[model samples]
Target: MTRETLDRQLHHIQDEILLLGSLVEQAMLNAVQSLKNRDRAAAHKIYQADQDINEKRFAIENAILILMATQQPMARDLRMLAAMLEVNTELERMGDYAKGIAKVTQRLGDVEIKIPIQEIEQMASIATSMLHRALGCFISENAMVASQIPAEDDQVDRLYEEIYRQIVHTMIENPDLIDHTNLLLWVAHNLERMADRVTNICERTVFINTGELLEMDTTDDEEELDSE
Candidate 1:
């Protein structure tokens, strides 16, 4: 294949990845909103939308595989192709997390409980923003933006901790709310994990630019240090 053709295919892959990101972002936002409004229909819709995200992801991966086999990309170009593959997988998993949140919303449909949702909502917001920024970094091949993206994960972690404590306290005080609160906890956990997946995407950005894979979870490091 000619270099020009390879470049065109790579650009197409980038566009498809961004398209997948947008769909997943919408899924997460809808899931959180559905839980807040107790809107079963909205939650179910997010679940249905995940099917499209999955299909798009498979198509992008197949295109990347074809390029890798036929183009024989070398050095930085090969690193980029590999990063796209990994980022594609991470994006798909992030979509699954969103779907998981939507499922929790469906399960809690009209249960009439007073579980706090603000922190979980905030977590989802930060996660989706991280994903958006990470994708920008991916498209621009900007390692600087990628390096900064993981710091945002720390905010999501703090929100997750707050939500967990609040839910546990509520569950303890009102034993009847245990089941519903547990489901909310699962939703928060899924959002937190999704934020982590965004960090993985950021790592892929750095990998694509610098050809180096770095772990960017400094929040865990600080926690361990404080415990010590």
Candidate 2:
């Protein structure tokens, strides 16, 4: 294939990546909304939608592999394609986190317990926003913007911690609520993992740009410590 054709294929793959990102973002938000409303029907819909996300991820991976095998992308182009593979996997796993949240909602059926809905919603919002920006950095090949995105993960982490503490305190006040609170904790944990995966995507963005595979989460953690 000509270089022009190769470039066109790569752009098409990038657009697919963006589409997958949007789907995962919506899944995360919908999962949390279902939890807040105790909407089992909506949660089931999110769970079923994850199959589509998984299929889309594989489709993107297959396209990248075909390009790599047939076109033989070189240097930066090869790196970009490889990075796309990694980001695609990360996005799919984020979808699983959403599905997990949906499962948690289903499991909590008929169990009335106080949920830290506001804190959980904040976690989802921050995580999905980080994911959105990380994908933008990927498409633009902006290592600088990519590096800045992971730092926002600290916000998600803080919210997760608050949610955990609140849930534990409530459980202590009413031991009978232990089972229900544990399910809520799982939701927070899923959202936290989603944010962590966004950092992985940002790392891929940096790798695509500089050919340097840096552990962005560790760097962000060290920066946080230094600030303290």
lDDT of 1 by residue, 164-196 (tens): 888889898989979888998889889888888
Q: Please give the clash total of every predicted structure, in order.
A: 0, 0
**Each prediction's Cα RMSD?**
2.0, 2.8
C-alpha positional error of residue 103 in candidate 1 after TM-score superposition, expressed in Å = 0.7
Angstrom error of the Cα, residue 39, model 2: value is 0.4
List of clashing residue pairs for candidate 1? none
Over 4 Å off, model 1: 221-228
Q: What is the lDDT of residue 223 in candidate 1?
A: 75
- RMSD of candidate 2 to the true fold? 2.8
Task: Put down candidate 2 lDDT per residue, 121-159, tens digits, no spaces.
Answer: 999999999999999999999999889988898889889
Residue range with the least summed lDDT across 10 consecutive positions in model 1: 219-228
TM-score, predicted candidate 1 vs. hidden true structure = 0.94
* Whole-model lDDT, model 2: 0.92
TM-score of each: 0.94, 0.94
RMSD of 1: 2.0
